[model samples]
Target chain A: MKTHLQNGQVIDDSVPQGDNEAVAGKVVSGSVIHIQNLRKEYASVAGVVPVLHGLNMEVMPGEFVAIMGASGSGKSTLMNILGCLDIATSGSYFLKGRDVTALDRDSLAHLRNDLIGFVFQGFNLLPRASLLDNVALPLVYSKVSREERVVRASDMLSKVGLAKYRDSRPNQISGGQQQRVAIARALVNRPKLLLADEPTGNLDSHTSHEIMNLFKELNERDGITIVLITHEVEVAAYAHRLVRLADGHIVYDGSSHIPQGDNEGTMSKNSTESSAAAHSTS
Target chain B: MISAMLNEAWNSMWANRLRTILTMLGMVIGVSAVIVMQAVGQGAQQQVRESIESMGSNLLMVLSGSSTSGGGVRFGAGGIPTLTIGDAESIGELPLIAGAAPTVNETAQVIYGARNWSTQITGTAPSYFTVRNWDIAEGAPFTDSDLRSVTRVSILGKTVVDNLFGDENPVGKTIRIKNSPYIVLGVLSAKGQSLMGRDQDDVILIPITTAQRKLASSQVVGSVRFIMVQVRSAEVMSKAEQSIVDLLRQRHRIREGANNDFTVSNLTAMANTAAETTAVMSLMLGIIASISLLVGGIGIMNIMLVSVTERTREIGIRMAIGARGRDIMLQFLLEAIIISIFGCLIGVILGIGGALAANGVTGIRVEITLSSILLAFTVAAAVGVFFGWYPARQAARLRPIDALRFQ
Candidate 1:
């Protein structure tokens, strides 16, 4: 029998017994990410404009969650905070059960290198580096030996089906191939969590589905936790769970199996409402 | 990790080969200029030091003072023949004076076989050789007995030997000076030049008694142009000079407050002044060349700044992949160091080549020292690090989010 807390509220309570032991300062929950009352603000010429207003979320290990939101929903900010690329204004955030808010800049960088991987929509590969070198980039920051880095990077490249093009530059490959290389680089470090921001935003429908299938396969086969951000219903449908944001607040958190027509109509209306809210605040 | 960053820097530099070379050009020119200028200036100083050494150490020249004639025409020092052989002999007996030689010189025509050349003839005792640190190359020098007997025997300078005797040994041969025949005694080992750029090995030596009797009959008895004095050591040079001046004044019976009839000049002090002047000149040359190195360092900073700005997106990508701020800084800094070191290497080669060429073309002395090469290398590296740091810091300070959003 255990007790659980969610969003500062006791959500689960088993039968109270005198023999039950208290965990005492240990987070017993097996969550990959835990955020409580996270807030972020930006100072503009007008005044302090608040972005995220006390958001709370939790992601369990091996969970495949898709975050969906319009442009002004603060979803990008949340993703940055999760990736350790940005910090929250207030409240505590934990990754892999370590307090991220207390870590310095360099420590955060090391955490990102050790525990998380990021994939961007731009397919940001070093223009002059070969695919093999690009995949080996994260291991360089980890102080891995040269021979081992080459071996692991080549192995990851082959897993992405880019073994034949290991020496090819990014410009020499197609957009789909480039995205695959980026994915290979992100996974070369074997991070516990993968954060992808619109991994298919620049791809066509067929390529988008191909990338999403690769993600799904990695999650199911390796039990790798994934937190991706997207607006398309089809992309979200590939994930096991979905989280939606509107006006800096969570609008939905449920299974990804929402009806297609209904989900599309709600997405459009939420986008419009968020845009209006953005105008009024500015 | 450092090797990986180095490899990345190499690739980026290779990708922009033209720009890299252009940026390196400034360093090349600056380093080479510094090397060449230092070589030239040091060469000049060395030449001056060598000439000063040839003039001998702890030496003094006592010149006869000016004399006013009836028409108020004043003759310069060394014109009145006030110093004499007796004065030189007395000065030689002083406690601090090592030796003194009375010398009289005049240009005269000399003939050996059919070859005749006009050359300077110096008449002095054999002790002049000891005072001047001169050595005889062949045969034997004239002795005190020869001076007493007033024998017309001469020691020939190398230049006089070359001109009058050609390849033949002039020893035990007769040479005519002003129609008076004199036997050749020996030849002098060559001393290249004096501090005044006068050829040292272009004069002939004879006994002072012989010059007074046979060459110039109009001069007063026992009188010579000047007296050459050598002190026992450098420490007592001033004391010796003061003693000599007082002794000469007492010997001449000069009245109180009256000017002496001779001037004693410390040749060593004059030589030191010349050496100091050249040292200052060398330092000035080095400083002027260092200004170019400063400009070259500025050029490196300018190019590094432009490179950082141009590669903002690439920096963002590296940061996203888990590169720390220091990692980014080191990468750019390494690139700058590589450029400067390579440039310095090429510049060293070119500078040595240029210095050799200048020496060959102009026949001027040029010295290239190991220390100078090391100095140029160290300074170039320091310049690279100093100039590269700011641009690297600017790149490091960039936020990953902002850099990623940059176009």
Candidate 2:
């Protein structure tokens, strides 16, 4: 497979899946993210249920991708494993050239502390703390001094356009503003990977667009690698690349119709469904 | 990081003002109760010591027994006159005996100039001053010559002088006791209340011979009411007492297996008994006060458990933000300690105020010692740590996913 890099999108003729996918060109991008045959299971009362069945996917540096799936698609499980909130039951998962599957809980915490920034769906913030303090929460775990943590947290809050509301608590602000504070907190540590598990899951459609626009600006300007998980197609429409999952496996991995201005592989049911969709659209 | 944790803990406390104050109220009541109760015990102990000290030096009283016997029936301890002046003189010669005085007291009407007062007239030798560790403020005590020659001379106590001779020097004055003219030789120094709550300075001192000759109506010439003995050394006080008993037994012809004819009472034994009683009283008070502290500690535990349950989502958010298990534990623990420390401060102020109030209202001494305050403070802090542990551990051990999922 060979990839041609446009200004802000990765358009590869052959999509990469796992470490063995041979990619020619700068699409490899220093092998920043590599996952091979990753699997996760949950022991429900009925029996041991496999959530992610030998899923394989890879992400290059500075790419803004969205993983879209319906309920029970295991997209959330894959996002958890990739964010180091959980470990894969089998196979290796790597980020920035380090195998995260073998790391202990403390080491994984350290990785999450310095490397990954997570934004949750509920805008999970300490309700009693000010916006600035909420943003500075993640930096408290770092070696940064108090003054620097404050300064950097303020800077991130400003970036999220909530600088004026820095002194207000989460309950005092609007839902969109609180979500912005959550985003500021996620970015305060200057992490390498920004992971959002439904960042606009609770916001109105217009406010969700505003949040998605902010994510787009952050990706374009800062070149920060981002992987967002959402079930909504309109929310996923803002990403440069789209990877769809179904029954714990990748059904489609290609550039979204927005960047490439192509309808190809947009909502492919399967490989056969992609052919059928191409014919039907023609 | 620790300061950050404290900051968060402080914020949580302020957010729930009523709960925080209620928790602290328990500690305040507990710590202050312990302190005030201990202060009362300490004050009581000081009063006991002072009361024992007012009696005299390490003294032993040998009172004549069988004085209460009537019709061949002995009633009580002081039933008969077993001590005599000759026995006192012999006991004085013993190496263990520092001093001995044969004392006989009688109530008499004293007249000086135009004023007259009824008072006690105690007859003894000059060695009575040494035995009771008394000093003459103006003139001399009646001497052995005055005792042997039966001189009609007297030394008035400060209280007797004040009563009979109002501000006038009673030394070398003439006072008639029971219509007998006796010259006042000197005025004795002032002594405070005795252990029996009588004024020690309310009597006149005169020669034993004079009293045996003129004043008291008695058939026995050499027999005295009691003998006051001072030990040469405090270490051999018991030895001195045993030797005096042996001498008295042989002198009175008290047979073996017979009851003692006299009662020997030492200040050391009296003081020890009073101290034991006070200690038992203090222990009982402390146990009762500590029950309040136990209830207070339980109150802390109950509230802390509620706080942990209420803040489960907060704990999850903190953990997701990179807080370790230790950090969560420290946050809750710090919150509890801060509450206890503030409560301790208020309790110390309240306890000291209570002690002062007790002193002011009841006119009873209430000594608030620093050691008791320190002990109460330490116990309060320990209560915080002890009662806070289980809830804090529960907070730390919570799984982040489950906590976040909880409503």
DockQ winner: 1
> B1-407 in candidate 2: lDDT tens per residue?
88887899889999999999999999899888888888888887777676666555778888888433236557465455667889899889888988889988889999998999989999888889988878889988888989889999998888899989998988888999999999998988887666555888899999987887688696377678888888888799999999988998899998887777887778667776887788788777777777787778888888889999999988877777677677788889888889888988998899888878888999766778899999889988898888888789899888766676679
User: Candidate 1: which docking quality band?
Assistant: medium
In model 2, the number of clashes is 6
**Residue B76 in model 2: lDDT:** 63
TM for candidate 2 is 0.84
Q: Write the per-residue lDDT of candidate 1 for residues A1-282, one digit (tens) a residue.
A: 222212112111122322212432355367788776678898899999887776667788888999887788888999998998888999778898899999887888888888998889989999999999999999999999999999999999999999999999999999889999999999999999999999999999999999999999999999989999997768987888777666666655656654333464354344343233333433
Best by lDDT: 1
Off by over 4 Å in 1: A1-29, A259-282, B67-73, B217-221
Each candidate's DockQ score against the native complex? 0.65, 0.45
For all predicted structures, in order, the TM-scores are: 0.92, 0.84
The candidate scoring highest on TM-score is 1
